[model samples]
Structure formats: structure tokens, C-alpha cells
Target: MNHDSYPDSYIRGILNTVKTIAMVGASEKENRPSYFAFKYLLERGYTMIPVNPLRAGEQILGRHIYARLSDVPVPIDMVDIFRSSRHALPIVQEALTLNPRPQVIWMQLSIRNDEAAALAEAGGMKVVMNRCPKIEYGRLSSEIAWMGVNTRTISARKAAASGGIQRLSLNRASVPGGATEAAAAAERMERERGSAG
Candidate 1:
């Protein structure tokens, strides 16, 4: 897709479908941008798996860190790449080797790898280069418009929730559905496993 500006639905469809993301290059340091992004995604009900060789075996935000994409135990719906542009291709290549390959490969803001994007797209994975899910979550969910500012309305619980004021579900990252998230994730992974098998 065009890095400059893609369709809103493209972004929405990703955020809606992917429930678990493995964030490569995540930092345990609290002051880093990746740190905040990780926290935000967690708060929004995303199950974030941190992937960094240096921090492997440690915990970030209560989630154990994996040394590489292949080390993650559970299915990762998306691989959020936080490395430099030059590193994206290798990461995407590695991501493609997973049992249930991630649906999306999202390179962080200021990071784009056209070759990686193409490779991933060719492998049937959606690509979002030079973008961050945290930012997209706000724009798509209208959190900037209604999440925080004084709306002064009393019966706006659902509205606030829609704006992502609440944790999990009903945001850009979730689709309307029944059953628990665990069940949904299992079902999704099972379906993909079957297709791959």
C-alpha cells in the first residue's frame, strides 16, 4: 500500500481483525516511545508480546519477552516492527516463517521498507509501513475527538467507550462478536492452521 496515505478501511480492517500483536524492538525502558506504545496497546486490550533478543527471558508489562518472532508460543496476529527501515525486510521475512503467519506487518512511524512490504503482501500478509498502531487506534476510534476532552455528557458511557475510554473490545481493534477473546483467538489460529496444513 502507499505509505503516504492508504484507505481508512485498510487500517480499520487490520485493527479490527488482529487481537494479538508481537512487538519487535520493544523497549523495557519506561521513557521510550515503544514503551508507551506497548502500554497503550495493552490498555486497549491487546495481548502484546515483546520481542527483543537483549530482553529475552525478561518481562515487559507483565508479558514475557521473546528473543525472536519464532520464539513466541502463542499465535501473533500482527508483527509490529519497531526497528529501523533497513531492518524491516529481515523481520518480515522471519515473521512469514511462523506456523500461523501474522496477518499484518506494521512498521513504526518513520520506518518503511517497500521490499519488505511487497514480500509480506506477496505472502498474503497486510503491510502498514511508516505507521504506528497506537496512532491509528486514536484516529480510527476517534479517541482524539472524544476519549479525553470534557464531553460534559452524562449518558455518554457507550460514546466514551467507543472513543476508547474503556479497555478492550468495541474499538478499532475489535469486531462485534460473541464468545470470549480466548475462544476467538483459538478459533482464528485453528482456521489459519488448517489452511496452512
Candidate 2:
């Protein structure tokens, strides 16, 4: 697991498998990166739980905010840390305490701690560092390319237009199959959970 680079399949696998994500350090500010990311992932259909100590007991995008990961009532398939690298260790430490620990520990862009990654990995969780899941989803799904951004990925198949919005799946395919793939991914995740449990 090289933190330097990740395979497209690995990222696609994660983006496809994860259903609920707990975004640590989520902010209420609309202009903040975390806020933007939270909104994006939510729109993309991932159940988002915001974790902000100061904003606890409040709602961000209609979802209640918790003071800490431990305070989250639901199982978090992935924990997306929007905090700095220095705070990553303690955050990972806390995430490790969950009854069914999160399957993934993701550190946001520009935030990476080898020690934290090691700790999470040692706990049997997959770790992604210095990457934004929002951006990864866009890139892997070819959504960024719709915005005229160079995703460096070329596909032979043209995406189907839905209400003038081009939505592609993680495997670089179009809609109808994306939904099926999502179902399959969920089944796979459940099977993995069954074996692990």
C-alpha cells in the first residue's frame, strides 16, 4: 500500500463499496472544503455523518453533527478525516474503538501521517492518505471530465446524458449498469463483512 499512488481499481473499489461515511472535521461553512466535500458525497448517495466537536448537536445539510466518532450512532463504513496530519493519530485511535471498526480510514488531501496509516492498517482497516474521496469519485467516475477537467482518462464509450448531466460510473461506464454495480458492490461488502465477522 504505497501512499505515493493508488491504482484506479483500488479507488474505484472503495468508492463503489462504501455506503456510509463519517466525515471528521466537517464544517458548517458553505465555503469550506469539507462542507463542499460533504455535500458532494451526500449527493453522490453516500450516507454522510458529520463529526465536529464544536458543532455537535447541530445539523449540517440536515444531518446531525456529532462531537466525536464515538458519538455517531450508526456504523461508519469509512471515516474521512478532514483534519490536519497532526490530528490524524488521535482520530485513528478513536476510530479503532468502534465495535465494528470502520473498514477504511481516509485522510483528506494534504493530510497524511504514516504513523496514523500504520496504526489503522494494523487494525485491519484499509488506509488512504492525502486524497479527497470527492475528487477521487469525480475522477474515477469521469465526472470531472464533464467539467472540462483533464482526468487523464480516456474512454471509448460516450456517457449517456440524463437531464443534460453526464454521469459516469466508477468503472468508466454509464448509468444503468452503475446502479447494478452498486448493488453488486453492496452484496460483496456484505459478504466480506460476514466472513470477517
Candidate 3:
């Protein structure tokens, strides 16, 4: 699997325009990454349909959980996959069977299936492998307030006053907790600033 994979401008355009997502391998466990990611996207106003065979017919984050992508009733703009690479092909195949077909297929961090990604791409779907939507949302959106700096909040004025280091390394791995939230918030903030400015 290529760890250097990235989505093109066309794929990014699709992700930006999509409002609905079907999350495959979404879990009911509160502590799981998929659970938090699903919740985050939902909180951000995106419609999220959770797909998990183990939790089919159950409710997660106020949305009905389906056993498979084809079971989702509404149209899906994207499919965020949390399953392993070995299991991604079938899911891609399933997503392809949708009426309108999904605009994007995203494989989570550490998950990459080239064959599946190629299949999706060949079928006119954007493919992103070994990437996390949450991370991309934060990075591309600029929700992080002080990415490299140690400070939690810094205004533009303050940045000017401090002679702006131009960068700060939070060494997130060193932070005890809230790393993901911090990153997401910073990314969101940055995106807002970019659009506003």
C-alpha cells in the first residue's frame, strides 16, 4: 500500500460539496475512533449514516445503523470506511452498487487497499486511502488555532506582538489527551479564517 496517497483537487472538490456520508464499520463504542469521527461529522451538520453489521437495526448518534452500505435508505455522498484493507474491496463493490453511486470512498488511517481504490476510481468515484476524514477536515479546514504553538489561543494581534514563530510543534504525541479535539478545533478555526479573510 502507498502511504503517500493523496486525493486530487477533483476529489477534494467532491468532499467539500458532499453533505451526506455513510460510515462503514462505524461502531457503537463511545471510545472508538469511528464513533467519535461519526459524531464529529454529525455535529458539523453533515448527515451521517452508520453501517455496522453488529449494530444493524440499532441507533447510533441518533441515526439508524444499517448492516451494510446497500441497506442505507438515503443517497450517500461519500463512504467513510473504517474497516481493514483486506475487507475494503467488498465494501467498495457494495458502494458501487448504489443507485447514484457515491462520490468518494475514504479509507481510514492505516487502511489502504490499492485494488479497491483503483476500482472505485475507475468507476468514477474519488478514492482516498490511509487517510482519516477527521484529520483532513482539520487540516484542510484550518480548525486548529495554534498548531505548533504551545498556547491554546492566539489572536492575530498577539501573533504579531510575539514576533510569530511562524510555526509551533505541539508534539501532540506528548500531550496527554484532547489531541484530536485540539487538532480538529484548530483546523476548523483556520478554515473559517481563510474564508473570512
TM-score of each: 0.76, 0.83, 0.71
- Model 2 is weakest, by summed lDDT over 10 consecutive residues, at 174-183
Which one is best on TM-score? Answer: 2
Model 1 lDDT tens row, 51-137? 999999999988999999999999999999988878888999999899898988998876767788899999999888766798777
Model 2 spans > 4 angstroms off:
157-164, 173-197
Kindly indicate the candidate among 1 and 3 with the higher lDDT. 1
Error of 2 at 36 (Å): 0.5
Stretches > 4 Å off in candidate 1: 146-197
> In order, what lDDT does every prediction score?
0.77, 0.82, 0.70
RMSD of each: 12.0, 10.3, 11.9
Arranged by TM-score, best first: 2, 1, 3
**lDDT: which is higher, 2 or 3?**
2
Model 2: per-residue Cα lDDT at residue 159? 53
lDDT of 2 by residue, 10-103 (tens): 7878888999999999999999999999999998889999999999999999999999999999999999998877899999999999988999
| Candidate 3 residue-wise lDDT at 15 | 55
> Top model by lDDT, which number?
2
| Two-way TM-score contest, 2 vs 3, winner | 2
> How should the candidates be ordered by lDDT, best one leading?
2, 1, 3
